[model samples]
Target: MDDTLTSTLELAADWADRFAELTTDERRQLALWLEESPENAAAFARMRRLMSDTALIDAFDKGDAPVQPLAPLPELRAGSSRPARADRRKPMLGRRQAIAAGLAGALALPFAGYWLAGGQTAGSPPPLRFASRVGERRRFTLPDGSGLLLDAASRVAVDFSEGRRHVLLEQGAARFDVRHDPARPFKVRTPHAGMVALGTSFSVDHLAEASELRVFSGRVRLDVADQETRVVPADRWALVHGATVSTGSFDPTTHPDWQSDWLDADAMPLGFAVQRLARYSAAPVRIADPKLASLTFSGRFRLDNPRQSLELIGALFGLRLEKRKDALYLA
Candidate 1:
């Protein structure tokens, strides 16, 4: 990396590290800094993007020594207009500003930018990680010709060892289309569940509440210890939430194609899909009624158009839509 880019990254890291506690003056200074150039703003965005990566965060947490206690969060005043962050998804260990900045510096420049798009070192090795940024999707093919279609803001770590092909879903969602090699088993895992492909294509989502698996073709076996291993075939789905496993079947034809840019909500929670759509919006999109978040909605909604999607959702739910200066609220 050049000197100018390096300097800009350093500045961006400083701001990102202290984002949760920026004073009014600091906020003004940051605005001034961002207004200085477009590159500066982009650099800051990249910083936050990397900060949100769960794999990079895993690496950061592992590298941290003599762990420190986290400070308690300040209470939100009653009747505050700002919505609290969703408990289902959040950047892990994001408060360790010092460690965050230091580790970010220690890692190679453009950690998210270069690595997620297939940057290689002197010798391309195992445990390669690929991630997509917020509101963006990415596709990758391995050396063995296996295809990976990564969902928006998703992260995955791949380890192609001599014995097995392993992929860990650190965060978000991903679809794996395996290149059949009976000699080598293909495994996909999240923090909660594990799967061994039966030479098939399947998708895994690491949501805040649970890990979901939807199989489109062939089969996948849930192969976790002490649990009854079950085979999930085409049009079948499975969910793992805190050691509890649930199974359901759906019509493959009616199920929205995962490859499309639109969201196929098959009885999905409103909050979850809203969280996904919020990435496309600049202002925070919040639900006025907390109870509505858990309401399930099954339909097709376009991802590219957040405004239209919100309007449709509001109409369906019989909620009022109000666009405020601070946020877009569905009441």
Candidate 2:
């Protein structure tokens, strides 16, 4: 019943808000704090469990129960800066006793959100695992009889269940050829948008943490949380970020080309293309002049021979290509 226990719980809640935003230094400090006392770590773990349990409750109440490839509790919800309501005048219960009391309601496990030490608590949602890297294209048949093509440096996770087909694109771009399932719709989650498909083929590109969804065929209802929903017609695209959604017509053919094994680009920045092409080479590639990074290029090159391509590109641009320690240098 000491006041110290109460302060520890309050501090744990404060740290939950920061887990996502903390800089490396702050995170290091947190590590030190946790290491300083076993009690501190225990309290933090309890707070995290509570946060997650609350999220599950919220998700269920809202009827958004996550399906397929169940995710660990999502990273703490955004804008959850509100403090836990507590009676300021109430006496602090013993740490062990308080946690014990919260444990008795087994049916409320999802709602209680408390767990013993060493159990899972909400953490960074694992970045969607991908089978491809930057500038590389990959194709895989999904479990739901659909097709998936992952673009360069893209990451995504798929979950096919009895009720829904959910895909989370952690980063970069991907094209989905979703099979028709009127009873169970296909959904794709990006940081900035949620796209629901009504039996269709579409591609979604998430750039710089922004979202752009393009439907090649069929229809997609794009929702930007709490914002107006938008219907993206076939062959058109919707660009969404934060709470804004802008619709425009774009050729799906022009999106990132994963069909090409080599580098396939259309008006990609010269510097970025160089960076990507560098991956195929034995040595690292460097641009000697900062100004060279500003140049843009559009073309497809076989990545198998990065050195040869570098030489060709260098000749075209009147630049020099230097190879050193597994890198190409554009001087």
Candidate 3:
């Protein structure tokens, strides 16, 4: 480094202390000088670097000598030339004025800027979370190949590590099309139950008062509590609540009609088909009475035209329809 550059570094070692001793006018004059030349900015950056480097050395020094405070000093541009004597001779500012000026320059502007930006207060927005709303369904693929289907009004969070994938279903329902990976098991958590899988397709539902799980393929081990460890086989279903687990053979057709968008109720009750059919229609569709709700019929009905399907359902049940405010109320 040039001799003037080396001298500037030496002065910078006590720059803050020297700055404290200068008069207000001298500090103002130095500010003006810095503003006058691009060289002044470069010199300021170098001086700051020099101060940081010196601080590290000072920290390692043997004596607990109070660090001789750094003082403000004249600027030096990088050159074969030395600093002009006139710049060096400019008088220094005193402690109180220097503190005030430093506070205004270093503290107030940042404080004002943050306040104006509306972020100067105590908190940041709560961390981002994920959820699905009522009557809505959603799908998400994890960083792993495993897929998750969220049922109506559900919330779940995903956390994965090198050894396993875990999901916490805070509420509602979902289905999992778990990818095959023996080293890592896919696990789901609910208030009522826990599901651990070894590569499977399954659905889990948690309503306000009930929870159920259905396995379409492969196997899943459900642990309800210490007294129960139910291993659900392929094509099976289970209803769980508190410490109880009730397992049974899966009805594969239970979800196919809704998934396929074709209402095929084979000898299913007339009121039952009507209730199922109501989901796809915009209009309010219901059986006229509880007695009518149980009447049975079976056939494939087009999901597209709920009116025609309802008419079919009504004729089969010996009921008639009345339209009120865009809804078909059965009688």
* Winning candidate number (lDDT): 1
Instruction: Give each prediction's root-mean-square deviation over alpha carbons.
Output: 17.2, 17.1, 21.4
Model 3 is weakest, by summed lDDT over 10 consecutive residues, at 120-129
Ranking by TM-score: 1, 2, 3
RMSD of 1: 17.2
What is each predicted model's overall lDDT from 0 to 1? 0.71, 0.61, 0.57
| TM, every model | 0.57, 0.45, 0.42
Give the lDDT of residue 117 in candidate 3. Answer: 20
Compared with the true structure, the alpha-carbon lDDT of candidate 2 equals 0.61
Summarize candidate 3's per-residue lDDT along 105-205 as a digit string, tens digits.
Answer: 33222333232122232432121124554444567655466777765446676665447678777666678899888888888877777899867888776
Q: What is the overall TM-score of model 2 with all chains considered together? A: 0.45
| Model 3 stretches with alpha carbons more than 4 Å out | 1-130, 253-331
Q: Candidate 3's error at 66, in angstroms?
A: 45
Q: Which ranges in model 1 have alpha carbons more than 4 Å from their true place?
A: 1-126, 223-226, 242-244, 251-254, 279-284, 288-291, 321-329
Off by over 4 Å in 2: 1-130, 133-136, 208-212, 224-227, 238-256, 260-331
